[model samples]
Target: MDERVEAVLRDGRAPGFHGLVVMRGGEVVLERYGAGPDHRLGEPLGHVTFGRDTLHDLRSVSKSVVALLYGIALGDGLVPEPGAGLTAQFPEYRDLAEDPGKAHLTIEHALTMTLGLDWNEDAPYTSPANSEIAMELAPDRYRYVLERPVAEEAGKRWRYCGGATALLGGIIARGTGRPVEEYAAEALFGPLGITDFAWTKGGDGVASAAAGLRLRPVDLAAVGQLVLDGGRGIVP
Candidate 1:
């Protein structure tokens, strides 16, 4: 609608930028889409001419959505509270839970990404060296995360760890007796009228709660609107 928007549409700025949707007082103010290359998970999808119907990967934005879903599931009493012991929720990892060093770890620590675990995402996502990619390649993602050497005391500091989101997704699935995507559909997306979306999963079929969500620009805007609306329709 303006020179800046026109420049973005031409890909002269933010080359891979796909779309934008702005709303004010729950009313659409401006909306735009553009042509760009896209990928599913990490696989190339070629160039795409995006529009209202086309789904765009949210990447790390998926983490925020997972957090919202966690809150919703918690409100339904389907997941553990923040104060609950982290490893205690995964009884299969008995030895890890028994570790006195990790005894201070709680769900709150994971929620806030303050578990102080030894994690590394400094590598490119395509590299196996990345902690997230390594988690996906592991036999058990939860154990891969929970077994990481403690870098510091839990809740002592905040750190960026996709493993934390994966653990939260596991907890939600374990408690709701359903996958994160399935629970999201029933509890969040459906209420928000987001019908067309894709959640990429790992080789083990678990959704990449860290960075796998895809939604159209308009629908993604609706999600932002929900947060602005104090989560009135879905989250508690």
Candidate 2:
């Protein structure tokens, strides 16, 4: 290990940092874990001792996995072209179809986070005002996302909208006739030999495409390796 890297890890350990993995040339060059008590909102839940088999929450990292699955869906012809209008796929959302701005939204917009919906995630996760929290609490998660007031024309600007990812998950479920997690297992994870993992779902029973996935760090590193391999044989 490089001295500078060692110094940084030493510093990170004091602040509840858990694990770090570094890969190069499709190989793990460094892997380390630190000891600390894992807590939720300042409440000490229990001590965490990380290891090779530890399943860590991927959080927003799941978004990347969702993106990969979308690619697979595209290859399998399960979804329409990127230019396809979002409203066309979910005609049941009659209210959204009437809104010209949202009606014009595209799969490209959702994938790029350019839906231009007014979303505020700057607040802490515990805050009800957080767009993500609000979406999670809504009765109809898809409707909650689709009904968000348009802040700008679709694809005109960038905004971090967890709702958009939720919509994408719904689209995946609709297109493939399977839950996002199931689709991923057959399409991506199975090929990658990633068998042990967890994907959380929203109230709608669809996987949370925005931020809910858990995997061992070693398996997560395999995802990186897959990318470095130019996505060879991972899809199709």
Candidate 3:
């Protein structure tokens, strides 16, 4: 372990973090645990006890990973082109087509968060403008995102479209013949030796691609190396 990291661990303590694994250059350079895996569980768990092997939620960072996977799917012919009609892919959203403007929306717009919809990602729960809250209330998640009013033309601007990420997840699910999490495992994670991981699905069963991934520190190190190596394929 580097002196700096050790210093941080000694000074700042994390609760419920019973294990930690630190690595550099794709190697396990440091690891600490309260005790055996069993001992660490069922207790508050100590600082530095959780690490490379222990799962840590990456939160919204999952969105980036999902986007990367989406690209892979696109390259592998597992996903439709950006110009494809989202409504055409999932006919279930046929009702959205009732609005002439809604049919014009495309996957590309959602990818860039340029859906032009009236949405406030972090609006108060009481506010109808909250994109997430509006999604919940809508009859369908995809339509909820697509039907959002056109603040501008598709891809005319960029916004933090978390809703678009989730909607893309759903679209990928349909194209790949599996859930995003599972597709990731089969297409990405498993090949990289990351077998134990969980993806929290939203109310709609989409993998919340906007942000929802957990990983172990060792696995984290492996991924770090992968990126540093110029996006070398994972699990290959």
Candidate 4:
């Protein structure tokens, strides 16, 4: 293991790699950090000297964290259950909800990333053509996601859609009557003893549940430990 770690340090193989941590039985067995390029939502941060305390972007890992948050909120009876109507949660988008076949959409579909919406992340995230980027640019992201042309029936097939997690975040925010970050702080981060972190928000000032989570390496591992421990801390 030491030799493998040394190879990583000596070789530039994993470009942009920042840190690694391994834990066993709730104890950290290995931890390491290295200097690397970083970014804040796409803005370059040049080369940064990383350490245990430096917070790093989790990217799509944010989706998993949002999933955890959804579970916590659901346990608190704050968010709708999986069987709840997806469009029903956002009554403001009446026109979209009334669209054919949309009424059949459920929260379970979003939770499973099988919403069947016409979504594409094939293009690079830096491009507006990407579905998630377009959603962030839209005036109302939730409306943008709901109004998309239905490409397939909900729950028919699995498709990767960051918008799904974004909807979950919206549900959590609306149900809890607080920002997603605020609820996360109280229900997740605070309970896990994670104090140094940042959740990036879009231009509309909404946290990007798709790819906005930042965490220190150790804190990220703590989240993993929580999951391994059957969510004893914050996820119920």
How far off is residue 110 in model 3, in Å? 2.0
TM-score against truth, every candidate? 0.96, 0.90, 0.77, 0.96
User: How do the residues 1-236 of candidate 3 rate in per-residue lDDT, one tens digit apiece?
Assistant: 46765675576553344466666666777776432232211223333344446676665667767776777788788888989875676677667766677677777876777777777777764465877656755666776776677676666778777778878888788888888998988877876788988776556666657656777656756666766776675422
Q: How accurate is candidate 1 locally (lDDT)?
A: 0.91
Across 118-173, the per-residue lDDT of candidate 4 in tens digits comes to: 99999999998999999999999999999889998889899999999999999999
Candidate 2 error regions (>4 Å):
2-13, 39-45
**Model 1, 3-100: lDDT tens per residue?**
67877656677677688897989988888777779998899999998888999999999999999999999999999899999999999999999999
| CA shift of 46, model 3, Å | 12
Which of the two candidates, 1 or 3, achieves a greater TM-score against the reference? 1
For candidate 1, the per-residue lDDT at 133 reads 94
Best by lDDT: 4
For model 2 the TM-score comes to 0.90
TM-score comparison, 2 vs 3, better candidate: 2
- Going through the candidates in the order shown, the clash numbers are 0, 0, 15, 0
- On residues 1-236, what C-alpha lDDT tens digit does candidate 2 reach at each position? 66766797767745666778888777788887766676432235588887877777787888888888888898889988889998777888887888877777889999999988888889887777999988888998878878888788778788888887888888888899999999988988889889988887766676778888878888899987887787896654
Better of 1 and 4 by lDDT: 4
TM-score of 4: 0.96
Question: If ranked by TM-score, best first, what sequence of candidates would result?
Answer: 4, 1, 2, 3
User: Which runs in model 3 stand beyond 4 Å of their true positions?
Assistant: 13-24, 28-49, 124-129, 133-139, 233-236
